[model samples]
Target: MWAAGNVSDVLAAVPQSAGAGNTAGGAINMDLILEDARRATEAREAASATPFDGTMEAEVSRRVLGTRAHGLEGPA
Candidate 1:
């Protein structure tokens, strides 16, 4: 558990509990990131997709920037 208040109260608290919890959370987050990357790679390969060529990338960027400038872009 996490707590914030008076300094003495905080000092008396068990800091290791938060440390252990955060360590567990970090591990879980890393596993999730790895799994997501694996899935994304699988999807890209299945699509027979290649990385965007420079011209195509530039066109997409132009359109996106134009839309944003015109306030036509949807919520991020």
Candidate 2:
């Protein structure tokens, strides 16, 4: 876990925890993006014959956005 603040006293505490939280979240998101890109590349190569209907992108966007909108707080 990432934490930033004074360990000894309350008055001495410099609030950097929120920045730490953002860094941690950004790291996780970058990792997910890299993994998804790799998988997408592999899938694209393997799916040469698959026809693309423009709606597929919209459908996928909707599903992912919906999941985010609802807050995926629990495990799948």
- Highest-TM-score candidate: 1
lDDT of 1 by residue, 1-76 (tens): 3333333254434675566556667877898999999999999878753668687666777777864644567556
> What are the runs in model 2 whose C-alpha is more than 4 Å off?
1-14, 49-76
RMSD in Å for candidate 1, one decimal? 10.5
**Cα-based lDDT for every prediction:** 0.66, 0.63
All candidates: TM-score: 0.50, 0.44
Q: Candidate 1: minimum summed lDDT over ten consecutive residues — where? A: 1-10
**Cand. 1 Cα-lDDT:** 0.66
